[model samples]
Target: MVGRLRARANASMWVAPALILVLVFIYYPIIENVRLSFFSWSAFSPEPRPVGLDNYRALGSDPVFWRALGNNIGYAVVSLVFQVGLALVLAAVLEAYVGRRLRGLLRTIYFIPAVISITVAGMLFQFLYDPHIGLVNRFLGAVGLDSLQHSWLGDQDTAIWSVIAMSQWQSIGYTTMLFMVAIQRIPAELYESAHVDGAGRIRSFFVITVPMVREMTTLLVVVTISGAFLAFNEVMVMTGGGPANSSQVLGTWLYHSAFLNDDMGYAAAIATVIFVITLAASVIQLIRAQRRRVET
Candidate 1:
């Protein structure tokens, strides 16, 4: 009995620090945000005034909020396509098509962008997109395609896409690396057997590689979706959700509501919505994966 007690105590001691941090940083803040969402307050307010669901109701009518949500959805779609889908293709090409001698060098080159700091990447893109004396515009002029050049970050029509492009460039390599690891873990014997059966590379990829990497693909999808919803830094640095709020996504909108607009209650409501969305997406993906595992 004493030995069991000592073991339990040691386990508790090992876990308590992490548990305390989660409660303080994650759980407590989530609960408090929910509570705050029920009230109205500004940073200068003496006390938060209970307003029930007024903040939510306002969100329903707020065009800016709708625009932000739409932009986030756009981000999610683009991330799934460029970050996840492109990564999968690149991984397949590297693992299957590339020669052994060049694969390592190519992987390092591809992953270099992922290692760059987001702030620096954003700033770099900002410089690249500048209309006057910027590389992009200069290149367009050199190619005799001057009509395609504009203030990439200043125009409302192009700003959000510009931000999304930067995000994809920075993140695609990380996703590709993950997919490459998944591909490597797949049994080489499967491909060998497929080759014996006269399966071409394309057919083998669809029949063997696709099915084998299903779980990793789903994981990357979930992560990309979550990241899309939480995206702030690129948007903030590149456009400041600017050109008249055309590039505002949920994260930046939330920040604007709290700090710039001083509407703490509304910001909390926005945060709650984002948490619910990300949580729901993650839960759905996990449940689907679990179901697939059971079936297979």
Candidate 2:
């Protein structure tokens, strides 16, 4: 009995450092942020004054906050459609149809943009969306679609969507690679058996490929949704939530409030909202995975 107790104690001792790091770096900051949300503070202020729920109350009436949240939701939907859904299909096609050498080359070509710095990608796309000399407009003019050309990023209506398109261009490749890895792990014999049973490629894909990669799909969905909510760099770099805050997302709005507007307390409240959303997504993923395990 003593030996078993000693072994358990030693295992805990080995885990202590990591546990401490997580508590200090992750949990402590989260708790601090939540506590800070209840206070009215600014960077210029000497101290935080307790404001109870005022900051959160303000959020309820803030039109910009609602617009930012709506943009985030739209971003999540588009990312789900293109990054998760379309990437999976592309990955499956590449894995099944392409030759090995050619597949590797194509993957490298696709993944190149993913490895590029987000800042660089943002800047590159910004120039591409410029009103006059931009490649997008030039291409439209070249193709005799000159009437369709407009200021892509400068226009209020097109600004957010243009940023989203840039993000999809940079991210689709990375998601495709992840899907390809998941698809490759599926057993070959399952596909062969499907083929033997007279199932076509598309039928086999829906039946075998997708079901087998459910875990990966779930993970990617959680990540993509959380990422969409937390998106800052691309918007900041490309539009700065600009042309009169038309493209603002939650993250940029938080930054704008905290630093630019000198409303740290309100920023903390926004942070709390982001945390709740991401945590909910994670919880949903865990519940679904557990239910699947139980069913199996």
Candidate 3:
């Protein structure tokens, strides 16, 4: 009884701060946000009117909302392909080819963008993409590719891509690091055995590395799905939903409606939908991962 009591006390002590923080910050805010999503209010209006399904109904018919939703999907897909895919490939190279010191040094260099704040990244991007005197345009001009040096962030067709590149620059390092860890943890014996049996690097990678890292890949996919669905910061900074709402995403649109337009109820409805979609994606990903795990 004495030992049991002491253990319990230790566990309680260890968990105390985390429990308090979760209750105060995380759970509390989540509950409040869900509550606020169902009501209508603005800056001057202190009271929120309960407009059950009207906000949702309005979003269904909103063209800007749909455009933003499409843009968010595009952002997520492109990010997944370029960001996570390239990260995986680079991580493989670093693990298989580079020495420890060199790999770590390269990783640190790549992670510099991620370590900086998003606001700073956005500001830096704005300058990099400046039409008249930007580095990208100057490089294009110098290379005799002047036709491609038009306004990047300012134009509707290219704004989202610019934001995506910015996101990729920031996030690729972390994802690459994730892949590298998973790859490094893989048993060396498997590769050694494969080498003796006539399997080349390409074949071994396909047979061993790819199958081994399925779980990490699945998790990254889930993260990408959630991040894309709830995208906000990049869109806000890079384009602010833009020259004509071309680069608008759900989060930015929600912000515009709730804060800028003072339509809290509508924003809440959008929030609720975003929450639902993200939850659905999580559930679907888990199910798929588990099925693959079982099958393998």
Per-model CA lDDT versus the true structure: 0.94, 0.95, 0.88
- In candidate 1, residue 254 scores what lDDT? 97
TM-scores for all candidates? 0.97, 0.98, 0.90
Q: Give the candidates in order of TM-score, highest first.
A: 2, 1, 3
Question: Model 3, range 1-296, lDDT digits (tens) per residue?
Answer: 99999999999999999999999997887677678776777778878888777777788899999999998889888878866788888888888889989988998998788788998998899999999988999999999999898999889899988988898888988888889899989999999999999999889888999888889998998898899888899889889999799899999999999889988778877887888898899899999999987886
Q: Is candidate 2 or candidate 3 better by TM-score?
A: 2
Error of 3 at 57 (Å): 0.8
Candidate 1 residue pairs in clash (backbone atoms < 3 Å): none
lDDT (10s digit) by residue, model 1, range 1-296 = 99999999999999999999999999999999999999999989999999999999999998889999999999999999988888898999999889987998888988999999899999999999999978999999999999999999999999999999999988998899899999999999999999999999999989998889999998998999999999999999898999899999999999999999999999999999999999999999999999999999
Candidate 1: regions farther than 4 A off:
none
Q: Flag clash pairs in model 3.
A: none
Which should have the higher lDDT, number 1 or number 2? Answer: 2
Q: Judge candidate 2 against the unseen true structure and give its global Cα lDDT, from 0 to 1.
A: 0.95
Candidate 2 matches the true fold with a TM-score of 0.98
* Candidate 3 lDDT score relative to the true structure: 0.88
RMSD of each: 1.3, 1.0, 2.4
- Candidate 3: stretches off by over 4 Å: 1-24, 27-32
What TM-score, to 2 decimals, does candidate 3 have?
Answer: 0.90
